[model samples]
Target: MDEKRRVAAVWLPHWPVERLYRADRRTRGKVQAPKAPLALAAPGQGGVRVTACNRTAAAAGVAPGQLVPDAMTLCPGLELRAADFAADRAALKRLALWCGRYTPWTAVDPAGIGEEPDGLMLDISGCDHLFGGEAALVADLQKRLHGFGLTVRVAVASTPGAAWALARYGTAPAFILLPGDEAAALEKLPVAALRLDDATVDGLMRLGLKRAGDLYGKPRAPITARFGRHVAQRLDEALGFAREPISPLRPPAPFRARGIFAEGLTRTEDIEEAVRLLAGELCRLLAHERRGARRLELTLFRADGEVTRLFAGTAAPSHDALHLARLFREKLAQAGDDFDAGFGIEAAMLAALATDTLAPAQDRFDAEGADAEALAQIIDRLGARLGHERIVRLEPRASHIPERAVVSVSAVRGATPAMRGWRAQVEEQMAAALAGSLARPIRLLARPEPVEAVAEVPEGPPRIFRWRRVTHRVTRAEGPERIAPEWWRRGERRTRDYYRVEDAEGRRFWLYRDGLYLRDTEGPRWYLHGVFE
Candidate 1:
């Protein structure tokens, strides 16, 4: 048993062509001689060129990168289709995501050339035991993918580079490279198996270094000097002398619980029941770890290979299983009628994507505490039903400008990070200022409206103003209150002079001048800012 990290590379040699067959089988329920010669063509320098070919086409000598006319000459029965690069990439992503049931760490191989992503990388380090052993895991993957009409070559190796190379270039359809045997096994493959681009591979082959073994004991200085560090780096990575990390489509959660049903579940009710049990198991894990889930995800893996994922989030960290289960209940209810069981669900996984420290609370309950919990449940339910982004609340920002003083954030996050850098100072300033002036108007316009005002003095309060094409006479007026611009932050903003006044109809208005008056200069423009009840 090798203690080093293990990676599984799954290469779909004809992904661009096979994906179309898979789609046909999925939508039309069966394939009509899908083994017939097929090739995908894309517009290249010289009109259309073949980008990918199925096994039958390859057998007929119609290989990729060949001109359409040449390939047609080689294989007259070839079914040609314009390459749907986008659909192929999306299907690859979906396939990679489906592999998560085997292990959480699965990513599309980053080494694919051009716009085509043809393989997946799986970090199956400690995950082999779940499926008996590494050999079983590889066999299971190949078998399942083959059942889906995909021709796959899978290899497990200690290093991702080695696994990727072996999967594509090794003699076997599915196999494993013992951890310490990478150097020996990799040497037999072509130098291109090391994931080098075309130019580097061509350059190395011209110098008679056509095999990985040719460079095994050769001087590194000359090879690196001619090809730069990339050649040396790829060699080191393939042999496990260098480190390479695969970025997973979704990072594995710290806390998780899995459930496998003996019989496939076809009804949504059964799925909900399974989710509840899984939630209970997950909450127990969180409690034992002294952590609580802030966001949770439920993944249902169907027997037919289609996966359904549902997500729920809470306003605060929670370990209560019932509350957590209710969150997903709302999601399932929201997905009513649109949810399909496909061929029935065979396994379910619940993971806490985000978590936080949660200390135990007192058993004694208080009215305020109960109300707070009730409110959190409401927020969670609403956020789950309506999108989390749609359920938001205004958070105060440390800004002097009224327009910039508040921002809308998802209510699922009860508070921002635990930093009080400028917020503490702002709170102190606000408390001190509250004792000096009356409260601000409850009704503030989104943006200040312009008004034509006449004042007795250049810096005094307005006597009357014309706003929104309506004229009003000022019956009660207050002195001007000046506000200076935040020059340190934004230098272009002007100083403002504000006043609180009431019209003859008892409607109170707050108005401000855009800039202070200078000697004989045109007075600053006046604008109505808010209204007071």
Candidate 2:
């Protein structure tokens, strides 16, 4: 049952007026949260209209949806601030991210079309115990937001709909509904508490259903015919009969370790120490699950609501705390001056984003294994400093063409199955080289350069060739090694005869004739393709 699911809704009543004047920019010396009577105004068919008002304006008989002239007459000293709907929405999202300090499962309440959002939702299912209990968690959350001069109301319950209704309509500022008590707790509230639109609420009120309890056990068919299924769906969701889950701003990482400090940490050294501790804790968590991490992320929450994140990846899955910590250290070092600890870092968390199953095994003591481990460490460090794409190794491809026989792949991915016989291939090439047989040149041209050649025979090696406006005579040459075109490819049906030739200056060139010898046809062309090392 979802009775175990605990969600909290936080409503910021004055957000529309406060967002404009809040001291939230990266730089200081800006406007502070409004304390005087203020109203947010927007352009309408009339001269102007008030969309929302602060507590002082509300107390002075100034309310929303009123013409500016009428509102000014009600509170002559009312201050008017242009409503910035876009900025308010963005600020609300930032506030939701700030709530990550309480729980990673935080999101801006999804507002319907034409509705302005001024609230946040948190799914703190298994997170309440960290702050003592459900009550204490709500209390702490409210206290911290109030510290930032925000006016908030909070409610905790088993469902998001229940919490949302209670936070906005319940009598108490901070309320908690015990599991399985949603119906009883919400019955006495107005029908609007079910989050119905004004037209629907008015229609229900006209039907003598002014309170949510009035809809209980009533015939659903008539209501469905009149109001469709939204009302019933919302009612079922709030009463815990149906599910309505909030989508968090960021999904919580499956494996994570968090650290909170009484006082903010300012020094880099202290943050590094905190990372070390978190790494050790994360490694233990992975070991318990018999998994290893391949990618990791570290998030630092600053006191000023600014968040900084650092990411690192490994060439191989690892549960070694020291090696993982070293990877983050390299990332931090690379960040250097870009890393800003504004005000101070109040909390930090390390999460394993990508993981793989790992089986325990004895450490290898052989030189080859040690060398491999060392190489992986180097790759990880370099990847952290530069980029993983920049750290690449050549992987063998299943192709006979010299140019198409290899591809570059990121080192972090290691090698592929096609590379299993790479060692044997290299050994065979070395044996040919030592036996005075010609092997492929180390440096191959992007495309063969056309050359003028004079061969001893029609299909034999070139006696001399002119390439790049330079002429060279062949001192010694090897016979033709015929290479045929791939049948699967659509190109000229011609075969190439490759030859290894050396000049008097000890410079070697690989030359090839384009076509086979024909009795009566256009003569074949010769090209210089490569230079030997």
Candidate 3:
């Protein structure tokens, strides 16, 4: 039999209130404030409604979704604060980062409609022993979080669903259910503890199924047919019959190196040295795995609890430690004053965010391939200094139209293989595609300019034309090659008759008559489309 994995859930019952309090304290620089009832509200149809409330507000008969007027009536001195969802989400992300010390795999539960998230899920699995045991870990987490002025409930179980249910509704600050004990431990909990919606819970209650134990032996078909598959799925997940996966906010890197300092270092040289050391260690890891990083991230954890991150990308996959360090140096130098070492950096972590397969290249005695590699490195450096968006190359796209045939893309990512092949084929077939004519223009106008011309007939080539106030008399005329619009596209379907004409001064011009003469329009319009060498 496979060993059961352990999971832990950390529930913060008053996250919104705590976040607001923290912000207020930080802005005011006051540790102690008035202990008045407070509530966060959002504009609703009737009036502003309470979204979250502190314990004091709850004790004064205020609840979430309650109208602000009613809450105010219940507590005359109630303090109502507008909710800051962005700040709350940012705080949750930072908390998830801080939790990285406990477990590498941690995910923040997304906030539900009309409710802010108050919990995080962590896959502890085989990591419980590091803090002595599961019970010890729970105690340590609770104690440490309590120092942050948060009221937290910690629970551990065999499944994420069970751990989440027990952590939020287990009637204790800390709870643990051994493997195979989930059913018994969750028997008396309310049906809502299964993560059901309010309507489902109310419907279940109306049917006299008030607790989880009441549905334990019932027929699955009847319940699922009435309440839907989610009910059965959640139940199964809690009982370990169905798998529930947790997606971490940041995926753990395969190659990582970290440095911890006893005393924070503030000097740029010290930080660069630390980065070099981490890059060396990371490159060693990549070497062992026979891979190279395409993108690297350097994270600095400040002593003042701020986190700074820097990113560098390579044109080609690279595993050389010195080259990677040099790229970071260039990035940092370009960052200049933006990369602030606020109150010094206590720790530095280097991670290979994205990687690719890299095989050892055979050394060459000549410098034939060396120049290409050097050029790629130079492009990489330029991309790191200026943003990648600023360093772009024109790539051929799959289009027959002159203007739509080419596009701009990041130089670091290179061009698509299909586009390159298409361009090559087009170059080889130029003569045949142009109908045996070698009069293709050297420069094509972005948008054709209208020209006044007098053709020999309504359907013939131009004989005299006035373009940009200059009259050109055609001495040689070649074609009336007809081109049609793409039928698949919507809009006006105009056919163009192009002509390669040479003026009396030996200057060649490509002009086209838009629309068939008297077929699609009353009179055809002449346009100067291109200039031939």
Best by the TM-score measure: 2
What's the C-alpha lDDT at position 180 in model 3?
A: 91
In order of appearance, the predictions have TM-scores of 0.77, 0.90, 0.69
Give the distance in Å from residue 7's predicted Cα in candidate 3 to where it truly belongs: 3.1
Judged by whole-model lDDT over C-alpha atoms, candidate 2 comes out at: 0.86
Residue-level lDDT of model 1, residues 1-533, one tens digit each, is 23379999999888888788778887989785477898999999788999999889999999888999999999999999899888887888989989998899999995544546799999998889988999988887888788888889999999998999999999999879888888999887899998888888899999999999998878989988899998888889999989998999998988888877878999878988998899999999999989989999999988767889998899989988999988888998998899988878988899999999998777655587788788888999889888888998777776666667666777888866522334775676688568664345767898999999998887788888999889999999774667765767665467777778999999999888888667324559999989998
Candidate 1: misplaced stretches above 4 Å? 1-3, 33-35, 45-47, 110-115, 362-365, 390-409, 415-533
Residue 101 in model 2: lDDT: 76
lDDT of 3 by residue, 1-533 (tens): 01368888898888888876666665665454347899999897798899888888999999988999999999999998998878888897887776665566888864332456778888888667767898888887787567566778988998988888898889888998889998898899998888888899899999999998888988889888998988888888988888888899888877888777877888888888999999999999999999988899988877545578889988778788888888888877987887888678877889998998887889899996697578668878888888777888767765555556667778888546854676585676685666675355868888899999998788999999999999999999988777776677678578888899999999999999988866885578999989997
True-structure lDDT of candidate 1: 0.85
Tell me the whole-model lDDT of each prediction, alpha carbons only: 0.85, 0.86, 0.82
Name the regions of candidate 2 deviating beyond 4 angstroms.
23-25, 43-49, 67-69, 76-79, 111-113, 362-365, 427-437, 443-474, 492-494, 511-530
lDDT of 2 at 116: 85
Q: Give lDDT: candidate 2, residue 133.
A: 97
Where does candidate 3 stray beyond 4 Å?
Answer: 1-4, 28-30, 43-48, 65-74, 85-90, 97-105, 110-114, 125-148, 206-208, 250-254, 257-267, 302-306, 341-348, 369-372, 392-409, 414-533
